[model samples]
Target: MLEIVAVPAFADNYLWLIHDPVSGETVAVDPGDSVPLLAEAERRGWPIGQVWNTHWHPDHSGGNEAVKQAGATVYAPASEAARIPGVDVALKEGDRVRIGEHQAEVWEVPGHTLGHIAYVLRDDGIAFVGDTLFAMGCGRLFEGTPQQMFESLQRIAALPADTRLYCAHEYTLSNARFAAAAEPANDAIAHRLKAVEQARQAGEMTVPTTVAEELQTNVFVRAHDPQDFARLRTSKDTFR
Candidate 1:
C-alpha cells in the first residue's frame, strides 16, 4: 500500500511524502525545503529514491540540490528542465514515473506556471496538482493565459470523481471564502467552509479534497467557460 504524509514547510506550503510501506521506498514532491523532508525520511527509515517537482518555482524546487545529495533522482517537467535546477530526469505528458510497484502519470497542467504539471497516481486515487487547482479556487495566472488555465482545469476535472487532490498549498479556508462570494447560493460551499474552519482550528489539514466535492463547490471547476473562468480569476487576483 502507498502512504502519504504532509510535511508542512515555509508558511503554507506542504511537501508531500509518498511511500511504499513494503519496499520502504519514498518519493517526496514539491519540497520547498530539505531539512524537514530529510528528517522525515530518517524518522521512517525509508530511503528516498525519487523527488518530483511540479514546477520550477523556488518554493517547489528549492530542495532539489539537497535531495540529490541524499541520493534521490529528481524529476521535473521537460518544458522547464532548463530552469529547474538539479533535474536528473525531465518528464513529459503521458510519461509514467515508477515508484516502487506503482506509477504516477505526468500531466501538462500549465497555468500557475508556464511549465506547471500535475502528477496523477491513478491506482492510489490521488493527484498532486501543485497550484493549478486549489480547494475552491485555482492558481493566479502567472505564466500561462487564462484560456490555458481553463483548459487545464477541464483536464483535471476529467479525472475520476473520486480522485483525491493533493494541492501543494493550504489555501482551503481562504479559497472557500472566495467560493462563497462567487456562488453565494452554494450551500455546499458554505458547509465546506464551516468544516474547513473547524479542521483548521483543530490544527488539522483540509486537503486531499475529493474531485466530486470540488466540482460542487469550487468556482474554478464550476466555471462555465474560458471567459467565465477569466473573469473569476481576475476577481480573485484583487479579492483582498
Candidate 2:
C-alpha cells in the first residue's frame, strides 16, 4: 500500500507526498511550496524522487524548481510546460508515470486551467484531480469554458464509486454551504453540509472525498446538462 501524507501550505492548499514502501520511492504531487513539503519528506525519511504537477498555476507549481534542484525529476503537463518551471518530463493525455511499482495514467481534465490534467492510479482507485473538481464544488474555470469544466467533472464522476478523489484545496465547508442552497430538497446535501461544518469547526481535513459522496451531494456534478452546469458555475462565482 502507498502511504500518502498531506502537507498543508498557503493557508488552504494541500501538497501531497506519496511513498511506496515496496519500492521505497517517494513522489510529491503539486508542491506549491518546497519548504514544508521537503521538511515533511525528510522527517519521514522519504526522499522525493519525482515531482508531478497537474497544471501551471503558481500556487500549484511554485516549488517545481526547488524540488528539481533537490534531485527530483519534475513531470508537468506537456501543454502547459512553458509556465511550469524545471519540468524534466512533459506529460500528455494517455501518458503513464510510475513511482516504484505503482503506475498512474495521465488524463486530460482541462477546466480549472486550459492545460490541467489528472493523475489516475486506476489500480489503486485513486486520482489526484488538481483543481478541476473540489469537495462539493468545482474549479472557477479561469482559463477554460463552462462546457469544458462540465465535461471534465462528468468524466471524473464516471470513475468507480469508491475511487478516492484527491483534490488540492480545503474548500469543503463553503462548498457544502453552496450545495445545500443549490439543492434545498436534497437530504444528502443537507446531511453532508452538517458533517462538513462540524469537520471544519474541529479543524479536520474533508478531502480525499469519494466519487460516491460527490454524486450524492455535489451540485456541479448533479447538474442536468452543460447549460445547467454553466448556470451553477456562474452562481457560485458570487455565491456569498
Candidate 3:
C-alpha cells in the first residue's frame, strides 16, 4: 500500500513522505527543510531515494540540496529547472513518477509560479498539490495570472471526488474562515469551519481533505468563470 506521512516544517509547510512498503522505497515531496524531513525518515526507517518538487519556491525546494546530499535524486519541473538548486530530472506534463510499484501522473499546474506542477496518484486517488490549490484558499498570483490559476484549479476539480488532496501548507483553519466569509450562506463552509477550529485547538492535521469536501466548500473551484475567479482571488488577497 502507498502510505503518505506529513512532516511539518518551518511554521506551516507540510513535507510529504511517500512510502511503498512492498519495495521499501520512499519518495519525498516538496521538502522545505532538511532537518525535520531527514530526521523523520530516519525515525521511520524509510530511506528516501527520490525527491519530487512542485515549484521553485524557496519554502518548497529549499531542502533539495540537502536531500541530495543524503543520496536522494531530485525531480523538478522542466520549465523551472534553472531556479531549483539541484534538479536531477526535469519533468513536464504527462510524465510519470514512480515509487516502488505506484505511479503518479505529472501535470503542469502553473499559477503560483509559472512552472508550478502537481502530481496525482490516480490509482490511489491521491494528489500532492504544491501552492496552487489550498484547503479552502488558493495560491497567490506570484508569476502567473488568475486565468492560469483558474484553469489549473479546474483541472484538479476534474479528479474523482474520493481523491485525497495533500496540499503543502497547514492553512485549513484560516482557509475555512475565508470560505465562510466568501459564502456566508454556505452550511458546508460553516460546518467545516467549526470542525477545523476544533482540530486546530487539539493540534491536529487538517490535510488529506477529500475532493468531495473541496467541491462542496471551495469557493475558488466553484467559480463560474475567469472573471469571477479573478474577483474572488483579489478579495482573498486583500482579506484579513
Candidate 4:
C-alpha cells in the first residue's frame, strides 16, 4: 500500500509526499520550495524519485532545480513546457504516471493556469488537485476564464465521492468563512467552518477533504450555471 504525508512548506502551502514502503521511493507534488522538501525527504530516508507539478506558478515550480539536481524526474504539463523549469516529462490528459506499484491518471484541469493538471491516484483514491479545487472554493481565474474553471471543477467533482482531495494550499478556513457568508444557511458549510477553526487553533492542517464534502460545502462548485458561477467568481475576486 502507498502512504501519503503532507509536508507544510511556506505559510499555507503543502507539498505532498507520497511513498511506497515496499519500494522505498517517494514522489513530491507541487514542491514550492526545495530546501524544505529535500530536508524532509532526507529526514525520512526516502529517495526522491519524481517531482509533479500541477501548474507553472512560482510557488509550485520553485523547487524544480533542487529536485532535478537530486536526480528526480520532473513532470509538468505539456502546454507549459517552456514555463516549468527542468520538466523532463510533459504530460497531458489521459496520460498515466507510475509511482512504484501505484499509478496516477493525468487530468488536464486548466483555469488556475492555462495548462494546470491534476494527478488522480487511482489505487489510493486521492486526487492531487493543486489550486483547481479548494476546500470550500476554487482557484482564482488568473489565466483562464470562469467557464474553463467551472468545467474544470465539474470534472474534478465528478470523480468518485470517496476520492481524497489533496490541494496545494491551506485555504480551508478562509474559504469556509467565505462559503458561510455566501450560503449562511448551509448546514455543511457551518459545520465545516467550526471544525476547521478548531483544527487551525490546534496547529493542524485541515486538508484531504473528500469530494463529497466539497460538493456539499463549496459554493463555487454548487453554483447552478456559468452565469451564476461567474457572478460568484467576481464576488470572490473583489472580496476582502
Candidate 5:
C-alpha cells in the first residue's frame, strides 16, 4: 500500500507525496516547490525517487528541474511536454505508471489546461486530480471549452464512488459555499458546507474528499448537461 502524504505548498496548493514503505520508494505529485518537499522528505527519512506532473502550470511544475536534479525521474503529460521542463517520460491517456507493486492509470482530463491529466490508482482507491476536479467545484475553463471540462468531470465522476479524490488546492470551503448557493434545494450541499466551514475554522484540511461526496455536493459535477455545466462555470467564475 502507498502512504499518501499532503505536502502543503505555495498558498493553497498541495504537493502530494506518495510512499511505499515496503520498497522504500517515494514519489511526488505536482511538487510546485522543491524546498519544502525535499526538506520534508529528509525529515521523514523518505527519499523521493520520482516526480509526477499533472499539467504545465508553473505552480505545479516549477520544482521539476530541482527534483530531477536530485535523482528523481520526471513523468509529465505528453501533450504538455513543451510547457513542462525536465520530463524524463511523457505520458498520455491509458498509460500505466507503477511504483513498487502499486500501479495507476493515466487519464487525460483537459479544460483547466489543454493538456491536464489525472492519475487513478484504483488499487489504492485514490486519484491525484490536480486542478481538474476539486472537492466541491471544478477547474475553470482556461484553455478548453465548457464541454471539454464537463466531459472530463463526467468521466471522473463515473469512477468508483469509493475512490478518494486528492485535489491540488485547498479551495473546498469557498467551493462548498458556492454549491449551497447554486443548489438551494440540495440539503446535502448545505450540510456539507456547514461541516466544511467548521473544519476551516479549526484549521483543518478539507481535501481528499470522496467521489460520492462530490457527486452529492459539487455543483459542477451535479450539472445536468454540458450547457448546465457551462452556466455553472460562468456563475462560479464571477461568484463572490
Candidate 6:
C-alpha cells in the first residue's frame, strides 16, 4: 500500500509525501518549500528520491532545486519546463511515474496555470490534483481559460465516485460559503457547509475530498456548462 502524508507549508499549501513501503521509495509532490518537506521526510526516516511538480508556480515548484540537490530526481510538466527549476523529466499527458510498485499516470489539467498537470494513481483510487480541483472549489484561471478549466474539471468528475482528490490548498471553508450561495436550494451544499464550518473551527483539515462529495456540493463541478463555470469562477474571484 502507498502511505501518504500531508505536510503543511505557508499557511495553506499542502505538500504531499508519498511512500511505497514495498519498494522503500519516497516522493514529494508539489513541494513549495524544501525546509518543512525535508524535515518531515527526515522525521519519518524516508529519504525522498523524487520530486513531482504540477506546475511552474513559485509556491508549487520553488523547492525543486533544493530537493534535487538532495539527490531526488525532479519531474515537471513538459510544457512549463523552462519556467520550473531543476526539471530532469518533462512529463506530458499519459506519461507515467512510479513510487515503489505503484504507478501514477500524468494528466494535463490546466486552469490555475497553462501547464498544470495532475498525477492519478488509478489502482490506489487517488489523485494529486495540485491547484486544479479543490475540495469545493477549483483553481483560479491564472493562465488558462474558463473553457479549459471546465473541461479539466469534467475529466476529474468522470473518475469513479470513490476517487479521492488531494488538492494543494485548504480552501474548503470559503469555498463552502460560495457553494451555498451558488446553490441555495441544494440541501447537500448546505449540509456540507455546516460540516466544513465545524471542521475548520476545530482546526481540522477538510481535504482529500471524494468525487462523490464534490459532485454534490462543489458549485464549479456542478456547473451546467462552460459558460456556467465561467460565471461561477468570476463570482468566486470577487466573493468575500
- TM-scores vs. true structure, each candidate: 0.98, 0.99, 0.99, 0.98, 0.99, 0.99
Q: Report clash pairs, candidate 3.
A: none
lDDT digits (tens) for residues 47-120 of candidate 3: 99999999999889999999999989999999999999899999999999999889999999999999999999
Residue-wise C-alpha lDDT for candidate 6, range 1-240, written one tens digit per residue: 888999999989999999988998999999899999999999999999999999999999999899889889999999999999999999999999998778899999988899999999999999999999999999999999999999999999989999999999999999999999889999999999999999999999998999999899989999999999999999999999
Off by over 4 Å in 4: none
Lowest-sum lDDT 10-residue window in model 2: 141-150
Location of the lowest summed lDDT over 10 successive residues in candidate 1: 40-49
lDDT of 5 at 27: 95
Question: Global lDDT of each model?
Answer: 0.91, 0.94, 0.93, 0.91, 0.93, 0.94
lDDT of 4 by residue, 19-55 (tens): 9998888998988899989998899988899999999
- Candidate 5 structure quality by residue, lDDT tens digits, 57-94: 99999999998888899999999999998999999999
Global CA lDDT computed for model 6: 0.94
Which consecutive 10 residues in model 4 have the weakest lDDT in total? 231-240
Query: What local lDDT score does residue 149 receive in model 4, on the 0 to 100 scale?
Result: 90
Any residue pairs clashing in model 1, and if so which? none
Candidate 4 Cα RMSD (Å): 0.9
Q: What TM-score would candidate 5 get against the native?
A: 0.99
Q: Candidate 1: misplaced stretches above 4 Å?
A: none
Candidate 3 TM-score, true structure as reference: 0.99
lDDT of 1 by residue, 1-240 (tens): 789999999999999999998777899998889999999988988778899999999999999889889999999999999988899999999999988888899999989898999999999888999999988888889999989999999999889999999999899888988889999999999999999899999989888888999889999999999999999999988886
Better of 1 and 6 by lDDT: 6
Model 6: residue 99 alpha-carbon error in angstroms: 0.8
Number of residue pairs clashing in candidate 6, backbone atoms closer than 3 angstroms, sequence gap of 3 or more or interchain: 0
- Tens digit per residue, CA lDDT, model 2, 1-240: 998999999989999999999999999999999999999999999999999999999889999888888889999999999999999899999999998889999999987899999999999999999999999999998999888899999999999999999999999999998998989999999999999988899999999899999999999999999899999999999998
